[model samples]
Target chain A: EAGVTQSPTHLIKTRGQQATLRCSPISGHTSVYWYQQALGLGLQFLLWYDEGEERNRGNFPPRFSGRQFPNYSSELNVNALELEDSALYLCASSLLPGQKNTEAFFGQGTRLTVV
Target chain B: SQQGEEDPQALSIQEGENATMNCSYKTSINNLQWYRQNSGRGLVHLILIRSNEREKHSGRLRVTLDTSKKSSSLLITASRAADTASYFCATDAGLRGYSTLTFGKGTMLLVSP
Candidate 1:
């Protein structure tokens, strides 16, 4: 089966601009997760969406948000992007939340560079 | 939120040697999972072990979990150049009804010939 797919392998934006990253979950998957991997900052959880609802989010700022469509696809929006936002954003999907008989598969990720 | 913190942020080993990475978390967890990520690529699931289980093995990968100590370790036997990557440990907090797997900073492993 095809793995999780992300669009715009790489993106460039300026400070204060808005950036949107898109992801399509594996077929039949209902949960999508967003993570950010910045230099010296490891992978940080950004948001989790399941069944078209925002299930949980990490300690990121409010400007970092995302939504899951009815078809289970997801989009992550970063408003007022800062140079700190320059990092690799990954999208993953699983059968359900947690480790309850579910394993996540990640996408190639979108590398966002903010100048 | 990130859960565990992996030790030996980076490790280098010779091919065919065994590689081990450790992780420790502060909160209680129901299960812990390990993932591998190639440079500039996405992560791939390696293995998962439940709290009640002490050890589990899959192919060349072995995982051990110690709930009392809130620590876990991943051991890759017969490592190869292709095994060079960053490994992360994710802990799933087994709350009443809501549980989520939080990942760590990860350990970068470099296997050379």
Candidate 2:
């Protein structure tokens, strides 16, 4: 089965601009997660979407937001990007974590370079 | 802040030697998992140990969890150069009906031939 898929392996955006990153979850997966792996920042959870609803979000600012579509695909939007925004954004898919814990499958990730 | 924190930010070992990494979390969790990532690529799930499971083994990997200490350890035996990668520990606070895993900064392991 195909794993999670992310679009635009690499992206470059100027400061104050906006960037959009897209991800398609594995077939049959209902949950999508977005994470930002900045230098020395580790994998900071950005947003979590389940069943077309925003389940949870990390400590990121409002400028960082995203949405999940009806088909379970997800999009992450970074507004007014800054140089500090340069990082690897990853998308993962999984079944909701509940009675039985579920493991998430990740996409290769998109390298976002803000200048 | 990430709930999980891994010990030994980086480690180097010979290919034949065993490599071990430890993770400590600040909160109670439902399950813990380990993941391997080569370079900056996507992560590959290695193993999952439920809160009730004390230990689990898969192939050359062994994971041990200590709930009292809120810590876990991962041991990769007979390591190879191909085993070099960053290992992360993730935890989920499952008390909530819906929850997500919080990943640690990760331990970078380098196995040399």
lDDT of 1 at A105: 88
Backbone clashes, each candidate = 0, 0
TM-score of chain B of each: 0.93, 0.95
Top model number, lDDT: 2
* Candidate that would win on DockQ: 2
Q: What TM-score would every model get versus the actual structure?
A: 0.95, 0.96
| Candidate 1 wrongly placed segments (more than 4 Å) | A98-101, B94-99
Which lDDT tens digits does candidate 1 get at residues A1-115?
8899998999999999999999999999888999899987888888889889898888899999999999999999999999999999999998856446467889999999999
Per-model DockQ? 0.47, 0.59
True contacts kept of each: 0.38, 0.57
Q: Comparing to the true complex, what docking class would candidate 2 get?
A: medium
The stretch of ten residues in a row with the least summed lDDT in candidate 1 chain A is A95-104
Q: Tell me the tens digit of each residue's lDDT in model 2 across B1-113.
A: 88899998999999899999999998888899999999998989999999999999999999999999999999999999999999999997765322458899999999989
lDDT assessment of candidate 2 = 0.91
Model 2 ranges with Cα > 4 A deviation: A97-99, B96-99
